[model samples]
Target: MVEAVMLWNEPNNLSHWDFKIDPDWKKFAEMAIAAGKAIRSVNPELPIVLGGISPIDPNFIQLMGSHGILNAVDVVAIHGFPLDWNHWNVNEWPAKVDEIRAVTKLPVWISEVGASSFGAEEVQLFGLQRMSELLLGNVERIHWYSLFDLPASWTATTRHKEAEGSAYYRHYYMGLLREDETPKMAAAEFPEGLGICQWFHYEDHRLDSAVEWLHRLKVRYLRTGVSWADSHRENAELWFDRQMKALEPFNTTLTLCFTPEHLGIAPHYTSPPKDPNTFAEFAQWAVSRYAPAPVRTNSAYAMPEEMAAPSVLR
Candidate 1:
């Protein structure tokens, strides 16, 4: 086929300039699989090559594994940029190390990536070789991201500019050759950007990570301006609403509200005169009194009140 026997899927690419970034890799991978299906329809026997610059999106891995397609790809690829996706659009790289290895249990490849830029030629080569060892040893099949001094237009550098024979500025000069495609000292050490090494041994996969992700929300997001009991209660409610999407995907809700015995308010509306400030204070009291009877961390975060007979709110 004009597109080659199989497609080189650049999951990380958007265009020559636009590189798509998906915060949720699983959903993004779903789309990728759908797209792959559409492509395969064009050439039934043709296999798909995934991971061109994809760099291991966890969400993507979950999607791929959930389906039975881990081995469906002809050549799996990796893009190891070694930074967060926000910085180098490659955050998924580190996290996806395991995912790629697992997927490569079938077939995997590295369509692109390299080492340090603006550093000596060896640094660039070293990064590529290091990642190559980890990936190659897993499945024994991969085409490294690249192997030559591609110009700045595609790779972004100017090693070719010195004219005084300074050898490493071709931006992606990981190839053991010159910009003219001539052989350099590194050319024969690796061939076609492919090599093999030991299977990866990452640090202990943290089990039941006790890392405190849900930090106690300080009263900081709650503006402590003019308020009474109601305001504090309402602030807690507001904070809950603001943070629910992050806190609860399985389930969550604002089940209660508070007021003084004489206020004659419902156990729901902590708004209007009853702003977030009042809500916070009310929540502090609620947790202090009726919070599940458990010794939660001394966190100053809770619902302004709990559901109970209207008289208890008083």
Candidate 2:
């Protein structure tokens, strides 16, 4: 029952991870939005969820909405992984959530969060801290990260056809459940995988993760117009350019949540912004202000149905 596929948290899903898109990276989102639309044309009320690329910041949300994602899903979600692969301190947690809000008006939820042990007590502290923040921040629900400790890292492999089998298994030890779905020592204390959990790292072993998700987005978008695929290519190009530029650090302080390998290339797409909150906020502003000025013509978004308010998932 993979009802939803979304991101975890800022700590777990970090920068080193890259997702590549075939043909082009930017168009990957267009595919998601497009599929959601087709699904909607039939059901008309299914809530499509989008994530697994959020936690870093809200720039992802802005990217999705501006690319026609807002109309695709019923609700948006994100992750908040806080530590590095080494379980080091990552001081920006709540700010990451702010980054999401900076872009779209969609209701949100905290998708993933956990702490791991790597000779640093502070690692677990972050999980406890985030749990407190969630409570204080009025978060409605939060599913703890690892229900068990694998003492190993998450799996890794290069799905990149270009990788030509260059990569191997990745080291990913973080999990709320053991391979058998049993609980780890930390998880045993809290069985449902809620209220906060701990992560175990597999410091060595293999490959990257995001590279696959991101690449899929890019390749799929170019091949198919998932969301706003049918949008005049001119409009998409123009919107993407303006939207990317607008998300720059100027007025707002949200972060820009793009990685270089979003499209499979080193310089594939947008890089991680120094201040994601500012960048994402500014980008949202740009999207709002840059709304295509109505020309005396029949544009794609001219129809009332086309202009309907977007939902969590269409």
Candidate 3:
């Protein structure tokens, strides 16, 4: 079951969003606002999260706030990759969260933060130690990037793969487990009670094992996605049902994003949709299906309105 709804994934990043087409993020705010409202209409107590901002930029969050986007969300989130991708040091995490907090009253979340085992497994081990120390109580949530590495044969999703050089290749090594599901050294040190960011592809075979790992890790929260693009494929509902069912044991934050090829302004998945409401419709459908509001009956066991209000993590 979904504990919260995260509107999109890194709208400011070229890898996840086409900023060239909607340079001001006006379209992104519009779609997010609409989706947030739709989600509320379905489940008023469900918290709506503004997707985790990559690069952890305060100016981008300020810009989204200017468009009244922050008003729609109950929490704001950010993603960081200090060891591999970001220029900032790993110790600056508190300052980073402070910068975002100064701009908004909503609780902040470290939605994605990880160290890749690309060069040596020791780097990931050290990163996990430092990350847990710097981030444990600094934010509301910390979802490690993934449970399994991206298979080397599969392309890493990025706007400029060739331009990123070695940095782009690190994507495959960000996982706690290798592509063959062997645990990296860092996996043993993963802090308990923190979440995991493990996106499941359509009909992914790793879902069961992934859940087993989460159980072993004693993780209570999860951050995953239901691609809008994948929703257009055959047997999509069957796959979605199976995926969500398997994940029912944890408190999940469902990220509703990715433009369908047919709905995008351009042919690519990163392109903005021609009609932003199309994305809103998809968000509404997912929430209504996966985390619908409880039916009001004449029973006396219903939660009071105040008690039903959305919780920060749940």
- Which candidate achieves the best TM-score against the true structure? 3
Model 3 agreement with the true structure over 1-314: per-residue lDDT tens digits: 79998988988889899999999988888888888887877678899999899988899989999999999999999999899989999999889999999999999998898999999999999988898888887787889898899987778889788588989899989999999999999888888867999999888889999999999889899999999999888878778879999999999999988999888999888888998888878887787778877767874544345533232110
What C-alpha lDDT, on a 0 to 100 scale, does residue 94 get in candidate 3? Answer: 89
Maximum-lDDT candidate: 3
* Candidate 1 C-alpha lDDT tens digits along 82-185: 52122443334444556766544545544444443335656555655565555545543443323334544443322234552433343344443444545444
- Give me the runs in candidate 3 sitting further than 4 Å from their true place: 298-314
What lDDT score goes with residue 256 in model 1?
Answer: 23
Q: What is the lDDT of candidate 3?
A: 0.87
Candidate 3 pairs with clashing backbones? none
Each model's TM-score, in the order given? Answer: 0.40, 0.45, 0.93
Please give the lDDT score at residue 172 for candidate 3.
89
lDDT of 3 at 147: 88
